[model samples]
Target: VVVVVVIVVIVVVVGVVVVIVVVLGSNGGNVVVVVVVVVIEVVLVIVVVILLQVVL
Candidate 1:
């Protein structure tokens, strides 16, 4: 379970980084989009963590 959580977090982080890079490259860095992506990523991670805790 821990390993899975770690992997999920890593994947999420990598995905967010890639998305931010792509967005910046294409749109010349839109702060609103970046912020929204980050917020969503954070919420996803938090929800995953909470679910894991509840399951365990």
Candidate 2:
């Protein structure tokens, strides 16, 4: 049950991040900025999953 809630929150946050990143990209975000943002988001997702694995 706790895991389900955590997964839901992660999914929501990821969706929001994707929308914001896409909007920024459309609004003249440089390639480097986009790449950095993507990499950081990937890292964040990995970290969260790893933490969840440990916790659960």
Candidate 3:
């Protein structure tokens, strides 16, 4: 149980960090694309957590 929680936390933290870095590092060209990317990342994180819960 502890290990599962730790893995989930790590995954979430890493996903958030990646999103932040990408958003901050990108040049200003398409705001819509940025928003879409952020939304996709968030959805991916949620899916990962849900899958983890189901597996554990």
TM-score of each: 0.58, 0.53, 0.51
Write one digit per residue (lDDT tens) for candidate 2, span 1-56.
47755875776587568767676667655555557766776776787778778878
Model 2 misplaced stretches (Cα beyond 4 Å): 1-29
Model 1 worst lDDT run, 10 consecutive residues: 24-33
Runs off by more than 4 Å, candidate 3:
1-29
Ranking by lDDT: 1, 3, 2
The per-prediction tally of clashing pairs is 0, 0, 0
Report the poorest 10 consecutive residues by lDDT, candidate 3. 29-38
Instruction: Flag clash pairs in model 3.
Output: none
> What does candidate 3's lDDT look like per residue over 1-56, in tens digits?
56756776676677667667777877675455657766876776687778778887
Distance (Å) between predicted and true CA of 42, model 1?
Answer: 0.5
Q: Output the number of the TM-score-best candidate.
A: 1
- lDDT against the true structure, each candidate: 0.78, 0.69, 0.70
Full-model lDDT, candidate 2: 0.69
Ranking by TM-score: 1, 2, 3
